[model samples]
Target chain A: MDDSQLKRRFAEWEQEYSKRPARACETLSGVSLKPVYTPLDLPDADYLRDLGLPGQYPFTRGIHPDMYRGRLWTMRQFAGFGSARDTNARYKFLLGHGETGLSVAFDFPTLYGRDSDDARARGEVGKCGVAISSLDDMATLFEGIPLDKVSTSMTINGPAAVIWAFYIAAAELQGVKPEVLRGTIQNDILKEYIAQKSWLFPPEPSMRVITDIMRFASEQVPRWNTISISGYHIREAGSTAAQELAFTLKDGLTYVEAGIAAGLDVDGFAPRLSYFFNSHLDFFEEVAKFRAARRIWAREMRETFKAKDPRSWLLRFHTQTAGCSLTAQQPENNIARTGFQALAAVLGGTQSLHTNSMDETWALPTEKAVLIALRTQQLIAEETGAASVADPLGGSWYVEALTDELERQAREYFRKIDALGGMVRAIEHGFPQREIADASYRHQRAVEEGRRTVVGVNRYQLEGEKLEIPLLRIDPEVEKSQCERLSELRRRRDGARVEQVLTDLREACAGTDNVMPLVLDAARARATLGEICQAMKDVFGEYVEPPMF
Target chain B: MAKRLRILVAKPGLDGHDRGAKIVARGLRDAGFEVIYTGLHQTPEMIAEAALQEDVDAVGLSILSGAHMTLFPDVVRLLGEKGAGDILVFGGGIIPDEDKQTLEGLGVGRLFGPGTEIREIVEYLRDRFSDRVAEETGD
Candidate 1:
């Protein structure tokens, strides 16, 4: 029989059988779910084109032919907090425990381009992530970790170019050349305006800095993934999966356009560009979202931008299990949540992964909780048979259908974004931010109305929940000591040289020149992150996000 | 008629995690409370000043950068100095129990953590301002 007969039969079966428990048949992204999917559901299911071989063009199944069978996903836990010395020790600890790569989490001050001594850095010196204020601190941050041996990913934006310069200088101190260094910088600034909101300069100047990095990285740090076009923050900030996929890819496309506008070849820089996504709670939806992400990217790069290189069509992403999905109630339950999410990520063919610690909702995770998180990934990679095959769930009718639907939705968003004159213009008018706020409010309302079930939150009620887990406490003395070190560096460094390099940086920011070399000079001259940023800020001015949800 | 229940929902410190604050602000708004949102990267001084100027019934400060100890108490003290000490102070974020207790000791009202129902915060505010709400709604 055909689709009509199958639909009739499905309706008859539905009429005869009452749905048990009476749950809403829908994904977390609010896509209405059908009871069951048949082959008829995929009307245009062209297997060769839509669901191609694992490593072929339109790589919907997987980016690599033998994804995990050849090599396991890099288990890079994002580790940082306190002073550079403190975070450096943690890196050694993680490496000793079998972690394959390094991911740095910079503190609030450093992320915002401030030294610990800046007035704005008060009470926040080493609170969120590791503090790296100068080349000295960067050197200390990776004192023993050989930059050439391990691939590192830094979560920095706004001032990503300067921080990257500091990293290169730090590596050079260890006798590592720039060409041999392998790492990624989270330099996607479009999302900062749209979701994360940790911006420094206005969009035009920010884009200028980014394009400079793209050109510089292709020549100098060829192995480095210039910008990890991110959806992690967008998802964490409460967007549905469709928005995250659309906005992130749109941001990536925007960067490609920016690169081309700056007179760079598409194939030149596109190969090194990577992606970052969130492995959220809805397992199948997330898997489909990832598959759809790769396919959409491959198609768009091949068709839209006329990218000739097949490497430009690939969408290699690093996945971090959803931090928002973990509940504070029954904190231990987060381990299981993270485990499932991590598995979904691997099944979706992630290139690398970060599993959030159970106690992250309360504070920065303690040592034990961090270990449990790392072990969660190890279990999936080594013990569980999930990673043995590429795209194990690629043939599932439900996943395929969802993949089609998500791609359709993302394309619809791309049209809306294009009509609004691209993502930057959309962001200027707060379109994406408003969309995320509305969706987040809707999800909250669903939970409040008992339409959605959050395991420990709305259901399985735990009364007067006392989170007894060991919490990592940032030492208050961290701020005090960090300030002392900053003052010491300032007093000892060549003040005239610092001022001269900063002046040169301001000129580079104002004129049509790549600011990377000057930024490296400033980093080498012992100019602080704050001072270097201040020099550019004097020319570009700081960004002030209009009041938005 | 009595004035509407006015509350200030603000993000303090450098961290840009504003999802919880914005949700709570809208939740309180939907619950018939007037919420003044301070957007992102708000200083404690700015928050206290805004609370005083707006004459909000309470100031709800959110911080997840692990600087709650420094930011929260500073906001409360500034409020007291500005002579708006009666404005209820409360918020949500990634605060430990011990820090919560100390903040409570410093006259900050009940704090909520992640996964808190928006209804719970709504009810907390409703209970705190029961007199005004009853007078306004004429219940």
Candidate 2:
């Protein structure tokens, strides 16, 4: 039918649907939805310019032309708890079970640039994630794992450079060169201040550290992704999907600007800048968010930044299912929730994926729970033919409309961020933080008012429910042993050389020098992660968050 | 009218997951409670000090770093040592059920886990303080 006839039919359907009691029609991000979409929705959409084929300019469809038909996504379960030895064993287990990549989760002290021996680190050492305090711990963590063969992604923020140097030095001990080492460091400090709140220094020094890593990696560790600009933590901090998309992209643009300002060429450093997104509950909205992310990044890189290299335009990302969507009640239900969210990510064309375990809300996943989460991804990749083609739902009217709508919403956000002088200043002003807080509050109210139905929470009543899932508990002895090892290393390592390298690092932080080499030197000199971070913190100073609700 | 229940919401340790803490604080504020939030990275001493300084009747400690075993009990102990034992101490995070009971035994009021409604917390606080509120107003 033509546009007029299609409009008339849609109106008639709306009238009939309105006669019955219709629930609130909107995505989880509060984007309004229609009962059905038609050809009229794509009235002005030009397929050639807007969405060329996959691997072409403006990668709205997918990054790779063949997508999963050529290769399956890298399957990584983000596992780390207790000591490095504890996590190394888990990594071997995952690899033996056909896992493709490795991702490390660090403890709070390690993430915040504090030592295991610091007073603030007490009771928190090796509690939430693996405690890697020194080069010895990094070497132990990767002892059996081959550095050259496997890819690693470390989910660290404030002390990314120190941890990354440790990894490189550990690889050197393995006789592996930095040139062949492959992986990503979650070095996005903007997200730290805005959402994750693991920031070490003020925004100025953080951006400088990020650019230094980018320039160094582009030269030496050519295969390594220096920064995985993340929106996962932003979403976990309770921002809506559109907010997640907008704020994350805006952050990416700001990084590009910083790199350029630091006297680095855009195309040289931009290709190594990867992205990380959260696969939220809203299925089509999430899929749309991913597509829109690629499209926006491509346009901004090619048109705005004038990046000549096509590699710089592709928005390669790793996706994790939303952690906030998991329920502590009827924990088994989370397995299903994760499965659907993972499917949404794959359908949206993720390069890598991590499926959250069922018992995460209670504690870190037990071996059994983590294995089930892995198998959920395995089933999606093998049992389902969802990845048989590139962008399987590419031509769907509803999905395309959603994709365009998300792009429009994100561009509006871009304009807003630009007006605020960029993401760094916006974060300093607590703009994104306030936005996330407001969104989270609205979401909580929706659940309480019965507008949002979380199964086994507000909707289903399971009387006298008991949590039967086993939880992984970090041994308190782990903390005692880790601290002991740290003290022993302090006694054993070349204390004089460590102090000299740290002083050099401190000077580099004060000056306009690329601090990565000094960081690597400090790593080789057996300087602890805390010492190096403190050396810089001594100069750059720490960020004190102004209280806001 | 009787004074609104004063409660202090705190983030103890390096756990930066404040989505719940902020929401709970805002929810308590909306429910007619005067709420004070310690933004992030607070020690047990700082939290206890803030509770005393704010003169809050109750303190809510939010942690997700699995240090609840160490930090939760420490907060209670510090409050007691500070002669603020009458101040109610509760928490929310990934605390296991057994640990939750142990914490309650150590004098923490009603530890809410994930998926807890703000209304449940508001109601619990109202019920716990209703008698004191009555005593305040001579009801």
Candidate 3:
């Protein structure tokens, strides 16, 4: 049919549909969703310019031509709790159960650069994630797991470099060369300042440390991804989808600028820089956000930064299903939510994905719940056939329009951030924090006022719901044993050598020398995580955020 | 008239998850209470010291690192050592149901979990403070 006939048909359908009006709906980002979409919605879309062929420039379709046909996205589950030995068993269990890679989740103490026995650690030893204090704990955490055979992604930020030094030292003990090490350190501290709030040093020194890692990794650990610029934590901290994309990509750009300013070539380090995103409940909107992220990153790297290599232009990212979207009311329903969200990530061509377990809303997930979450990914990959093609929804008019709209919104944010000097300056001024707080408040108000329907929360309430699923309870004994082990380690290690290394580290932090080598030496000399962090803290001091309302 | 019911919002231990604590602080502030928020990574001793220095009537400790079993009792003990035992000590985080009773038994006033309404916390504080005032005044 031609334009006039299509318009007439739409008018007739609208008249009939209006008689039985459906409830209005909006996406998680507050974008209104239309009932029906057609060619008329995408007026400015150019087929070649906007949605290029897969593996080509402006890769809205995907970064690779064959996509999953070439190789399936890595099924990496984020798992860690208790001592290093305990987490190692879980790692072996996951790898035995068909997980493709490992993602380590450190506890609060480790994330804050505190040893298991520190006074501040108290009852937090291995509560949220595994506790890796010294190189010994790192060695135990990966006792039999071959470093060359599998890639690892560690989710620690403030003390990322120190923990990474422990991992490298552990690998060295296993006779693994730095060149063969494949993994990612979430050394993205800007996001820490913005959302996560796990920062150790202030922004300038933190950026210096991140640049040091990038330079060292690019030269020595060529296979390592230096930083996984994260939007996952930002979204989990209650930012909207557009805000997540914009703030994250801007953070990525800030890192790029930092690397360049530090005298590193863009292509040399940019290819290894990756991203982590959150796939929320809105299927179409999440897919569009992912697509727009790629397009925007590619344009900024190639056009703005004048990057020459295509590898530098690629926007490789890992995605995790949103944990904040899970409900404590009907915990079982979380499986279905995770399934749909994982499918969205897969369809959006994520390089890796971690699906949240059903019991996470209450405590750490049980082994049974983790298996279900893993099986959800397997079913998506093997049974659902969603992985059979690249960008299955690429040509849909609604998706394209949404993708364009998201790109437009992100560019607006970029302009605003640029006007505020940059992301660091914007964060220092509490721009992103205020934006997220406002959005969070607005969403909570919507839920409270019944304007939004959260299943099992406001509507379809179940009376006197009892949580029947088994919750994973970390034994308080774990903390006691970990503290004992740390004391034993301190007693065994060479105190004079540790002191010498720490003094050297403190000097390096005070000077302009790259501190990664000193950190590596300290790790090898049996310097505890807290000891190394304390040395730097003595030099760089700690970061205290301004009051953000 | 009772000095606006001063409260110290402290995040004890190493947990960096402070969204709930910040929200509650804001809630108390909007409810006309004087709120002093101690940022992340406060030890039990530091928290007690802050309570003494700020002269807060109550101390609200927010911990999500599953360290409530150790941190809560330590805070109470420290406050007692510092001669501030009469100050109200409340808590919140992802504490399980069974642990809630244990924490309360350890002298914690109340423990709020996720999805708790902000007004519920405000009301609980109001009622507790008013009761303490009545007892002191022999009403």
Native contacts kept, each candidate: 0.76, 0.89, 0.47
User: Which residue pairs show collisions in model 2?
Assistant: none
* Listed models, DockQ each: 0.79, 0.91, 0.54
Candidate 2 lDDT by residue in tens digits, A469-542? 77788899998998899899989988989889999999999998899999999999888888999999999999
Model 3 chain A, poorest ten-residue lDDT window? A441-450
Residue-level lDDT tens digits of model 3 in A359-421: 887888889999999999999999999999999999998899899889999999999999999
A best-first ranking of the candidates according to their TM-score comes to 2, 1, 3
* lDDT of all predictions: 0.92, 0.93, 0.91
**Candidates sorted by DockQ, descending order?**
2, 1, 3
Q: What is the per-residue lDDT of model 1 for residues A1-549, given as tens digits with 9 covering 90 to 100?
A: 578888888788777666555655889998999777878778878999998999998999999998888899999999999999999999999999999999999999888988898888899989999998999999999888888899999999988998999999999999999999988999999999988877899999999999999999998899999999999999999999999999999999999999999999999999999999999999999999999999999999999999999999999999999999998889999999999999999999999999999999888888889999999999998899998888999889999999999999999999999999999999998999999999999999999898888988899978886767888999999989988998999999999999999999999998999999999999999999999999999999999987755
- True-vs-predicted CA distance for residue A199, candidate 1, Å: 0.7
Better DockQ candidate (1, 2): 2
| lDDT at position A210, candidate 1 | 96
Model 2, residue A164: what's the lDDT? 96
